[model samples]
Target chain A: MFAEGPSVFSRFIVCLVLSFLLIVIDQRQQRLESVRATLAVVLYPIHLVVDFPTTLVRATAEKFSSRRELRAANERLRAENLELRFRMQRYQTLERENERLRALLDTSVMVGQKVLAGELLAVETTPSAHEIIINQGVRSGVFPGQPILDAEGIMGQTVHVNPFSSTAMLITDPRHALSVAVNRSGVRAIAVGTGSMAQLDLNFIPNNADIAEGDLVVSSGMDGVFPAGYPVGVIEVIEFEPTAPFARIKLRPHADLAHAREVLFVWPQTPEQDTPAAVPATEAPAP
Target chain B: MSLRNLRGTLLIGLSILIAFALTVLPLPAWAQAWRPAWVALVLMYWSMAVPERVGVITAWFIGVLLDVLVGTTLGQHALGLAVIACLTVIYHKRLRVFSQLQQGSICAGMLLLYVTLLRIVDRFAGVPVPSVSYLTVVTSALLWPWLFIILRDVRRKGGVR
Candidate 1:
């Protein structure tokens, strides 16, 4: 039974070459995304099975918590909810006024976005790739490039959507970048992930820029991926290097990337509204 | 195929599935870097146990499945696992006669080769280099003896070959 067909070396070479071709095709083009997504449908069940132990542990913990603790948590949530409701009333009035002003200025009104809530399933194990798998995906109308947010601020965007789950590339991933503005001065710059969970880098800002430590940074919406005015981070440090023309600015992300369990998937306005005309009048020119 | 052969194949398939599940199980952030290469170990066992039936192709298929599960480049694991399976097939005869400790050392070497190839491909593709986690290889090597016993038990129970 052991001494059969193709020699081991020949079999190895054939499979190796085939895999090399797959690697080349997958890396260079978008052709394999559909294949990957299809395969993900099959893989989703295995993820659920793997996640079962954690789910069971959480459920058991919840069951064992004291009634007094549950009541306390409920009371706290109600108080927070009441506070948010009051703030929302004020925000509605301000939104109406802003729309009227935009009408007066003959600019298109900023459209309200629809968002779907998603529970995070898992975080990727690789430290360098800061990504999370969320429970929402193509079946729930989630798509690649959809902005993900938490209660505090923007988290990241979905990079791959399978049938039952989507993988979001966190804003703190080294490969990710988004256009951001210093809220105090409306100075625009690209905030790039520094591969660290706690920090983001604002690059290409001149040494003389008006940004100061502790200033808030918000999405500029110039890239059209993230909606404008969403809080992204707060400036933590601004260093002036003797050799470089730009200041090295680092920010602490407002979103709790390390602990977020639930996130919002925002469907941004269509690509037509992403044109230059939609940019706010005070936006700084792109660097 | 005979009933015994079918049972053997099923056992092999079950082992692979278990290996994949173990590979993806969530670990604490501090423990993730030390995860043993479970899939590679299982593939190595089968390739050595039944070299002709479970050679490079089976390893490649399992590797691709792992790549998809881990969400990496499609062929990344396939290449490494295929090479390792080929090596196991070439040396299975000599390996069978060696002591368990000696076999464990060779398994560590193969795991090192797998990690090295994976890192080289990642570097060439411009993915950020992972911090050195030779602990993964060390842990996998340490587990090889137990894994060998368990798999041998399964194979004998299934009456494979």
Candidate 2:
């Protein structure tokens, strides 16, 4: 008498089974890459359609220009440009000194990595997940595990790469851990996400670790994911727990990741392959 | 889909678009921890309001899409979505009579529950548990009343659903 309609429990069971299958396939295999890529391509037009209203409004606003406001903006920009030029001269001198120091120390001279600009396409929709989608992806030379940076400093690493878009797992994601060094002391520690966007927990630090508030944390370049010497965070608070062996240290990220309008993807360069060592003639006699 | 039925389809599609847009909006790094779950929230609302139209399978499909979109373990979001959809289906009759504010509160709780489930799944998968952002779920719940009102208004104005 129920008209043979699918029961909610049955439907849920079906959904759970199907969703689990999809999940297993997606996680264990690379089979869904093509499907994801195709979906991204097909979805591009929809994005364009969705963004049209905002673009139209912006275009309309651009049409109604006021001369006074333009003049004010122009003057402001001119002043900022003059200030930047002065600072640039100082930076040039510092760069020369830095180069000389690097040469003397016999260390590889650090050069800025080439960056591809990207726009935020989406934030993590799951409350507990710390991630964002950017406009750049595999198509734009972006790859998974590449580090993302904002104007201030390190933002995150690319976790998922689509054809036209990539998902950046933010430093605040509980799953994220970075090998970082204290700039002042050169002591290395792993910074893990506390699930607080504002703070990170420095794990595995000894109770007597020589760290204090305001110490700058930068990438140690040990992981090969993030570049060395980029600002990651600043020590915000430290709580010493007598019962726990590790110090409960917290830090604030240098980058304003949540509100970042533009981000840069630092593409990784391929490392030189090591040559296989030749077998000693003495040991090769049996062969 | 027929032209007459197409309107409803478009409305639901637009809601998904809204979900996507909301998901992508730039927020502060500190706020990232507390950002509300968007796609699931939209799907939950729609599935409950129009269970005949949107089903558990559909919710699961959307969750998978979100998983692909967000780059999380594929089954995690799908499982969470299925759970929420089941809840929505079970409570839809009672939920339909609640005020927007009351419904929003429920939505917020459901979203929080979903997030907790996601975290549990993530932990089982060896991902670290994110700090308490239950506030985000609460805030998302707070947004439900307004979203419900606005969406209802949009539906009435568009005559699409």
**Which runs of model 1 end up more than 4 angstroms from their true locations?**
A2-6, A123-125, A270-287
Candidate 1 lDDT, B73-145, residue by residue in tens: 8788899999999999889988998999999999999999998988876765557645236689999999999
Per-residue CA lDDT of model 2 for A1-287, tens digit only, reads: 12113587888888888766766777567687766666656555544554456556766887776888879989999999999999999988898899799889866666445789998753344556677767787878887788899989999998667787777788877778888899999888888877678988887787888989999999887766777789999998888898999888899999996678689988544334222232211100000
How much is the lDDT of residue A3 in candidate 2? Answer: 16
DockQ of each: 0.51, 0.33
- lDDT, candidate 1, residue B20? 79
Candidate 1 local lDDT, A185-250, one digit each (tens)? 999999988778899989889998898999999999887678889999999999999799999999
DockQ of 1: 0.51
- RMSD after Cα superposition, model 2: 8.1
True lDDT of residue B86, candidate 2: 84
The lDDT for every candidate, in the order shown, is 0.84, 0.74
Can you list the residue pairs that collide in candidate 2? A122-B24, A123-B23, A123-B24, A258-B27, A258-B28, A258-B29, A259-B27
Please report how far candidate 2 places residue A9 from its true position, in Å. 6.3
